[model samples]
Target chain A: MAEKHINARGLQCPGPIVQIFKEAQNCAAGDILCVEVTDQGFKKDIAAWCKKTKNELLSLEEEGGVIKARIKKG
Target chain B: MSENKKTIIVFSGDLDKAMASFIIANGAAAMGNEVSMFFTFWGLNILRKPEKIRTRKSFMEAMFGWMMPRGAGKLGLSKMNFGGIGAIMMKSIMKQKKVNTIQELIESARALGVKMIACTMSMDVMGFKEEELIDGLEFAGVATYLGEADEANVNLFI
Candidate 1:
């Protein structure tokens, strides 16, 4: 199953990060989280987090004015 | 032990940039990671009381001239020159769209245990008294900031 949430589209940089931090806490080992953001600064940032944490980024896409990211817990 | 912390050394008071620094530090802290913000020079202005803000705001404010003090208009990035009007308009739009104020965000960061440090040198230079700043700010020197920066998983200068 997939859990999707809208986060920090127009909020700001760390807004999305704050959402990711919270989600990472409740997530199971295999749970999927979709983060929708519009901050361009987060493109490299979220990728860096995935690489560092060993989590799997299932997908990253942009629709309209939002950056949608899907990540599966490691 | 928690994950390696992220340390940000902020030298500018530009609202947008400082807000970005605070957001990163607070985000990292909320994630069970340590976070520190080193405020230097113009960046220290954010910590000052509302009175000082008005004095600075008159000259530095880049957006909506009549907004409240301690508002986003006083931030370093949102200043009146170096692309002032556009940045101000964007900030006004962001505010209209429900972006949280910098002060509110700072409070959230503090609640999450993000460390806030103001530079002693900068304070001395600015001639700010302890009573002039908001409560609960930690003051220190470059060495202190550097020590934390050394152990940081991510170090940012904003």
Candidate 2:
């Protein structure tokens, strides 16, 4: 289970990613964060952010219209 | 590859253009890139305070301030301004689309540590007071902008 959950659905490009950046800061090392977004553009953006911030992207899944990303803080 | 460095010169005070600048800046900063934005000419209007603040200035300077948009919220559209109503419609549409507003984008850029610089020459020419602009800004000349742009991996003028 994710230690923190972020509901960023319906947000446009960059908004969802910004929210993830802010929330990820509060997560301790080894804590997992789950982000829910509606924009497909976030797929690439989240991957880049995770790599830049040194976080681990465990999984990214899409269901219906929602995209869920699970990231482990590093 | 080496770390990315992005620098932008904001020369337009239009709402859409300002929005674009912030969006790019925030994205670059989020990706661990060093981002710098230099506001000059009409672009300085984007940094003006929202409320009307009376500052002692020459008549010409006061007129310039009065005529320009107060802040990001008051900037007109570059094209199809439609007497300023177009800007209002655009703001509404952005809200409906769940896009970050220009003001929100500016805040995000600041939070992400994007360097905000005001062109000293432009400020003098436009008769803008230091107090009239937003806080957390570095004042410099064109040389300063060039210095940063020279080393930036991505340089843009908007």
Candidate 1 CAPRI classification by DockQ: acceptable
- Report backbone clashes per prediction: 7, 0
Candidate 1 chain B weakest ten by summed lDDT: B60-69
After superposition, the stretches of candidate 2 with alpha carbons farther than 4 Å from their true spots are none
For every candidate, how close is chain A to the native chain A in TM-score?
0.85, 0.93
RMSD of 1: 6.3
Give the Å shift of residue B29 in candidate 1: 4.4
lDDT of 1: 0.72
The alpha-carbon lDDT assigned to residue A61 of candidate 2 equals 93
lDDT of 2 by residue, B35-129 (tens): 99999999999999898878888999888888889988899999988999998898888889888999889999999899999999999999888
* Model 2, position B24: C-alpha lDDT score: 92
What is candidate 1's lDDT per residue for B14-112, written digit by digit as tens?
A: 777867877777767755677889888777777766654332432324242233234334654555545556566757877886676777778878877
